[model samples]
Target chain A: MLTIHTKLISAMITQSLKDHPIETCGIIAGLAGSNLPLRLIPMRNVAQSENFFMFDPQQQLQVWKEMSARHEEPVVIYHSHTGSEAYPSRSDVELAAEPQAHYVIIPTCSPHKEEIRSFRIVDQMVIEERVQIVRQYQPELEFQMMVA
Target chain B: MSITVIIPTILRPLTHQQKHIDMEGSRVSEIIDHMDQQYPGIKEKLVANGNAHRFINIYVNDNDIRFQDGLATSLRDGDVLTILPAVAGG
Candidate 1:
């Protein structure tokens, strides 16, 4: 299951809508071995196609190096589906090389409705998972409730 | 010449879970061949049709080999070679 902050989801949704009709992709990085995604980093879709998305080779290398230096990993790899439903396409499964990442898809096909779905595409198998959007992470639950 | 290769998570199994490997080569193709000698199946994962697979990016010292001579891209000692699978889809 993907347990993420609402702010990150909002950012992803906004990016998806902003780049609608052209599939946009990015990754949310976090400390290595920590499932908690902390920072959202958007990648330019070099393909710039409504049906396809690819990261610029130079940018990808740079970002990956930075992540390694920071001792982080891409916890969530996200993209948008402009022409179809929010699910892994044939190409999506073929291109899923990061088995440890949460493949999140934002569907902007409908103008009035917005949806976000997460999946685990490993070894060409797409397994949908539940998303738990929280206002804040753990360790402050009682304090958060009192403040709320 | 010794080239340091930073392997990604997916390819770590082939490297015996070694995050980074040092091998001897003067060019990108030679390095790949040397790696294959040690790790039998990793070459096919990185190369296809005599070229670096389109789905993977091979960067030598922050510059992608594709912008150079591809598999024939020259390399020097102490250069950092990083291989990352492309995060792309339709």
Candidate 2:
């Protein structure tokens, strides 16, 4: 299962709507070993295709290094499917190398009624998981969330 | 001749869970060859048809080998080479 902030979900939906027809991809970074996503990072889709999404190589490296510097890891990897359902395609499964990250697929839809889904794709297997939406993070973690 | 290579998590099994290792070589291709000598089957994951795999991005310091000289990109002492699987899909 995946638990994410409402603000982060809104950010992703806004990004998806703004980049409609062109796939959008990004990651949420959290403290390494924490598994709690605190930062929402929207990446550039270098592919810029309606059906494909690829992060800019340079940007990916920079973000990855920053995560390392901050002792963070990508807890959630997300992308938008403009014309398909919220599910991983065959290619998505074939290319899923992050076995530990939750893969979130959000189909372009009415942001007010979006039904996004999360999955764990490991070794060609795709297992759907539940999503827990929380309005408020722990008071202690709220500071980090605001800082993000 | 000593170059540091950073391995991604997915390929850590081939490197015995080592994410970083010092290798000796003059070119990116040679470094890969040396790594393969130590950890069999890793070369196949990074190279295909005598070229870097399309799904993998290899970097020498801050420069991507694809934008430089592909596998022939020269390496100097203390250069850091990083191998990351492309986060992409259809």
Candidate 3:
């Protein structure tokens, strides 16, 4: 399962809507080896095509360097489907290099009630996963809720 | 200089499923050519018509070769080279 903050989802949705008809792609970085996404990085879609998206090579390199310096890895690799459902295409599954990453897709076909989904793609296999959206991370609050 | 070439998942079949290969080369082109020698037909996937494939992105130690010197990008000992394919976003 993939757990992410509500604020991050909002930001991603906003970006996706702003680039409707064109795909918006980015990575959420997290502490290396932790698998917890905490950083939202919006990247340029150089392809600028309604059917495909490619991160600007220069920007990708810069962000990757920064992540390396901070000892972070791309925990969540996200992209938006402007007119399709929140699912990985055949090409998406074929190009999934980071097997450990949570592949998140947000569908922007309709402005109302967008559906966000996550998946794990490894060795050309796609496995849809559950997404847990949290307002905030509070150990005590979580414990209290569990008890109640 | 010894360089580490990171093979993307899509091209791993050509490299016998190896994710990375250590080779010796001082330039990006030379390393690619050497890789072709080791894994025949691999270069065609990364390059086409005397240039890096449009869908392929090559980076050296987190810096894009296109922004630097393309195929002629200079390399040093222990440099990490990453090759990845451009994928659909929408």
Candidate 4:
């Protein structure tokens, strides 16, 4: 079971959904610590989509290099379903380049139905996992809330 | 009592483009009932005939109601219910 820093990722995803509600996508950068122990950081989102999120090869490489510089591993690649269920389509599984990366799906089927779910897509197979969302308010967001 | 329900982006079309709505209820279930009375097919998407939808989650003041009373979760004045869509990308 993979635990998610719920509030942090949720905020990122909420913004992504609203920003690119049509087809939002991004990358999750974090430590891959395990019994094996992999420490990584400097998470940045490399937003992409199948038909809508094609990034230039150079841009992709740049992001990967950035990840390397930060010692962060590709823990997961997330995108929204956008008016559909949170299950991976055949195309999503076929494009699972990172067997180690968890393919997270954010279903924007209904604004009133905000739910976040994660999955692992490997070898054209989808293995679902539960994520624990731990919300820590960004100082800016906190201040805004306080002021309001 | 009547409270306002905020619908997320994905589910807005179903709500006829109205982002915010007012409904009457003492509990979450009652609010849902009031919404169903206003919009015909809404409750079906929210509560699967009997149980809540597998993909939908209801939050009151940013706290997930699933950890609370499910549909029976109580509501009060000035309370905000944000209907968030389950997002799966990253």
Candidate 5:
């Protein structure tokens, strides 16, 4: 399962819509090995193709350096599908490099309605997972609420 | 000069599951050619028609080779080379 902040989801959807016809791609970085996504980094689709997207190489390099300096990893690698369903395409499966990162897909074909989904693609296999959106991640509050 | 080449997970199988490999080359293309010699079938995945594949992104010491000299990008002895696919969908 994947747990993400609502604000991040909102930002992703907004960006996806704003870049309609061309897919938007970005990474949500978090503490290394923490598995907690906290940062929403919108990236440029250098390909700028309606059928595909590719991050600007220079920008990607810079972001990667920043993430390394901050001791972070891409907890959530996300992109939008403007013409297809929220499923990993053949190329997506072939290019999935992060086995530990959650692959989030926001389908904006209709623009009126959205179906967001997350998957784990490792070695050409795609496994859909549940997503829990929270306004805030409060591990301490969870225990207190459980006891209350 | 010897450089460290970090292989991405997708290409790990072709690399005998090796994550990192040390090879000798001064230019990015030379290193890629050497890698292909060591692990057959890898060059095709990384290069196509004498150019880095459209989906492949190679970086040297945190800087993308595309912004530099691409396949002709020069390397130093302790430089770290990373190969990753372009993250995209839709």
Candidate 6:
């Protein structure tokens, strides 16, 4: 099980909203052990839908390549529902092809309020998992993680 | 009582393009075995040996089977089993 910093996740969602108001999604890749350390890897947007996302295969491969270069595997995938609950729609569940990765959704249903949720997409099931975002700053950083 | 198993698009090849299949079993494992018998080689897409594919996620009703008994998860009459893919989009 991986644990993500809630504050970092919040920042990602907030930035995603601004970057792709229509709908935004990305990947989080990191080491699988200790602190469950992770790095958010933004993916191509799954063009807007009535209440779902349509993922892009080409982008997926690109992200996969990037992770491979860094020896990091995709651990979670995140998207935003501009005006719906942070839950997987029937379509979302049907299209989840990577069972090992987590599906995270950021719901912008309520104006001025943003909500983030994470789930595990198993064959025929969507499992909600626990996520934590920390609030701290470590300047003079040697490693730079992308949040766009 | 038998339940209907909904096969996702990615898995339709295993079911000959049938979206829904009916089977009878008290546990998920039994249902999988039943499917294997009905459709030769179907088990390869679902379970490997006595375990399930790491990417396949099973759900009873709307809850994830992982939180339940996994392959041993129980089923009741009229329950719905959905087999979905692990999609990676936005």
Best by DockQ, which number? Answer: 1
Report clash pairs, candidate 3. A53-B89
Q: How much does each candidate deviate from the true structure in C-alpha RMSD?
A: 3.8, 1.7, 5.3, 17.9, 4.9, 13.7
lDDT (Cα, tens digit) per residue for candidate 1, span B1-90: 999999999999999999999999999999999999999999999999999999999999988888899999999989999999998999
Could you give candidate 4's per-residue lDDT for residues B10-79 as a string of tens digits?
A: 4666688797898778788888888878777778768875656644657766666777888888999878
Can you give the lDDT of residue A44 in candidate 5?
90
In order of appearance, the predictions have TM-scores of: 0.94, 0.96, 0.77, 0.48, 0.81, 0.55
What is every candidate's C-alpha DockQ against the true complex, given to 2 decimals? 0.91, 0.81, 0.43, 0.01, 0.52, 0.12
Angstrom error of the Cα, residue B51, model 3: value is 4.8
Over A1-148, each residue of candidate 1 has an lDDT whose tens digit, in order, gives 9998887888888888899889988999887888878878889999999999999888898888888898988999999999788989999999899999999999989743368999999889989999999988776532322110
Please report, in order, the local distance difference test score of every candidate based on alpha carbons.
0.89, 0.89, 0.82, 0.59, 0.84, 0.67
Task: Give each model's clash number.
Answer: 0, 0, 1, 29, 0, 20
User: What ranges in model 3 sit over 4 Å off?
Assistant: A111-113, A138-148, B1-22, B35-53, B60-63, B66-88
| Worst lDDT 10-window in candidate 4 chain A | A34-43
For residues B1-90, could you state the per-residue lDDT of candidate 2 as single tens digits? 999999988999999999799999999999999999999999999999999998899999988888999999999999999998889997
Per-residue lDDT, model 1, residue A104, is 95
lDDT of 6 by residue, B23-69 (tens): 99999988888998987787787786677665565677776676788
Q: Which whole-number lDDT from 0 to 100 does residue A75 have in model 5?
A: 87
Question: Tens digits of per-residue lDDT for model 3 on A1-148?
Answer: 9988777788888888888878888888887887677778888888898878888887876776687688887888899888788889877886677787999998889653369999999888999999999887566433322100
- Cα lDDT, model 4, residue A114: 52
Off by over 4 Å in 6: A19-21, A32-37, A136-144, B1-90
Clashing pairs in 5: none
In terms of lDDT, model 6 sits at 0.67
